[model samples]
Target: MPNIVEPKLISGNANLPLAKAVARRMSMHRGMSVGLVDARVERFNDAEIFVEVYENVRGEDMFIIQPTSRPANDNLMELLIIADALRRSSAARITAVIPYFGYARQDRRTKARTPISAKLVANLIHEAGIERVLTMDLHAAQIQGFFDIPVDNLYAAPIYALDILHHFKDVSDVMVVSPDVGGVTRARELATRINAPLAIVDKRRERAGEVAEMTVIGDVTGKRCIIVDDICDTAGTLCKAAEVLMSKGATEVHAYTTHGVLSGPAVERVSNSVLKSLVITDSIEPTAEIKACPNIRIVPTAPMFAQAILNIWNGTSVSSLFERETLGPIYEGMYSAA
Candidate 1:
């Protein structure tokens, strides 16, 4: 950490813990004295949002940190209003530091004559006065191109790889598995770095919330399998993939997902599944049930995120940050690293 001109940081109600962690790693304590606008979001009789920023934000380098996770509409609107408030108050520059960008998966229209909402979200953020955008593991990398503003898409691969190495003494038998075909590239890169094998879960989506589990692509029998998915919404797919591998004679099964958007019944499914455990990054806030689950775990991405933020703030190269790896035991009280 070098001495640089610190910008005034501000956070919304989306995921304050993550924002605070980022601030702490950067050696800045939030809510010390700076007046922050209180986002009083309410719903009128018609169920429309009414947002207002309570404090002044005149002439400051404002960074609005909101993830737009569950209840995405509310969180997204909150960010828009916050940025609008800053703009009206004449903030020097506004940067939207979203830890998790919602609606990224809808980057393209899989069907005919449908809207590309991801691009629309990008447009809305820009119109809301965002000069730049910073987020992690967008569902589709191409979403970066959709925004004209300077955008940085950070990767959690290095952090995940390092964790895998430290967790298993000999990762030679560990198989980095992609839950579906699209994630093969990501899975392959991780497997190559750890010098481990790779596997793929051939699945057929019969319909929404229904996945038809096909055979495992590579040899995972009697080997440790680590399923990789960008985001685990219901935990159904990952859980089923893990079970399939285990049934196929896999020794153990673990999941490393970047964004843990565990919606309804996700925590319950993971708890009852045959998977040994799950290793997830704190990209989104986990529910109480998700935390209480025996097999579910969380790894903080604060240090990696902090370093990237610092690099951005200081005008340094952050591309090389992807070269590093994160390794450690995912088990609670076993080992922790970023």
Candidate 2:
């Protein structure tokens, strides 16, 4: 057999902490020698992005961990620049481990002249020489097809289920809630995994990021409700849904989201809302305001990202990470040890 190419992990300024954590986990797993690539991604005085890889990457497999979160344009540019740099260095293959895919909300055009920015972004990644993409909880599932290359979309349902079971010792009175009808499928999967009933919040959006009115569809009376969604930007929908759930007699309201794009007044809204707690992953790095918010809690996704990187590097089954029982223990062990 030919010698296996050791994977090289690199990251942009977007969520560097998550990238470092993933590198640490990979290094600790089975005595693997994986580490972050010696790369310097910086911005020029005029705000132009520059990337310089210090170490040799020729014939090596590369995983770039970058989330196009806040300052989406800058972060996205950094990713593209880094990928171009790595490709020029002749890396064997480059996989973008985008924990939170930005521009994803614009996957489709709802109006006459609006652009499908997600497809444009996907094409840009392809042109930048990314061989594959690994993202979690995309806003729209069909965005995967926009890429001609292979795309692996991971779910955070397993992580949420484990956290929920640990938090609510007895889940007998728990209910999974989807803030909008579009998210019923995602919420239902989590509900099924945890053996709980599913609820949907019927809301009409007068415009993007604005919810007109919300009504609870299912009976949440006296139940601990957990709202599940992919992104939590501005948080108007989540907050409104929680308020409606509480009015409908839900005992408590909690939120579990994959990408906490807590932009603008999101932190303030979540802090002042009826939500008992907001659990999010480290897909987007939390700001100081988010950290100081008492009700906000974050679960690390580094272990899962590390495992996925290793699996893809070794040509293993990336989908198996979705198994609840298996995912929980693995996440706990790696996270606890780290």
Candidate 3:
């Protein structure tokens, strides 16, 4: 038999709670006894980041969990430093598990003299000695191509599907609304899963940090609309889209996003908007203001990510984790009780 290597999980300071949860779930998997690797990540008085791996990681497969969310630059630097530390420590392979990849919005240049920051970040990771990347619901699917290393970009559709089924007894009354033309593909997937029709919000951006105007493309009359997207920033777009849906006779509006990058006035906007609820995964750590917002609901992505990590470690296909049948038990046990 060939030599078998067990994977070691490590985490940066970006989101310790999420990392801990993933580690706990991995430990629960049968025939797997993986544990979180000890590490110290701190900052100097002037904010220079430092990382030190406490235990032996030599010749071991290592997975580092870190989401580049708020303070994107700081968190991103931390991830890179941690990956560099692992590589220098002689880890067999290093996979950066970034659940919410920041700087992904700039995957392309809309005009001249602009940089593709996403590709730059990808190159940085590659240069940092990472062998692979595991992320979810990238803003643009093409961003995966930016990385030369193998990247597994997972989807939150299955998780949203399970949540929809749990909340809506009659799925026929539901409609999935893409907040913009770019998100139609994502919305369509969820719509197909819930057996609902699709709608789009045609909106134009007048300038940065604002949405000029929006128009509803399909009828949402008398339906419970769920607006789907990958990221929720200032939420100007989503809130505006929800208003359009409501004006078009939708009874209620709900929003589901994989990463809740609720910056600026997002929480305030969502709280005052017509949206009945806003659902987001724990891919990014919630701020105190986010917790205080009653309309915001957080769903755990730990079980799904835990399973994906196991599959990758076992050299098995991770795609099946996105299937509802494969995730039925996990979804039922976790969300059905909520």
List lDDT for all candidates, in order.
0.79, 0.91, 0.91
lDDT of 2 by residue, 96-145 (tens): 99999999989997889999999999999999999999999999999999
Backbone Cα, N, C clashes tallied per candidate: 5, 0, 0
- In candidate 1, what are the lDDT values of residues 32-149, reduced to their tens digit? 4433345566668987666666665566566777898988988898888878877987877788888899999889988899899999999999999999888888888899999989
Instruction: List where candidate 3 sits over 4 angstroms from the true fold.
Output: 1-4, 31-33, 335-338
Segments in model 2 whose C-alpha atoms lie over 4 Å from true places: 1-4, 333-338
Q: What is the TM-score of each candidate against the true structure?
A: 0.88, 0.96, 0.97
Candidate 3 matches the true fold with a TM-score of 0.97
Better of 1 and 3 by TM-score: 3
lDDT (tens digit, per residue) of candidate 3 on 81-185? 999999998888899999999999999998999999999999999999999999999999999999999999989999999898887778788999998898899
lDDT of 2 at 80: 96
Q: What does the lDDT read for residue 167 in candidate 2?
A: 73
User: How close to the true structure is residue 41 of candidate 1, measured as C-alpha lDDT?
Assistant: 60
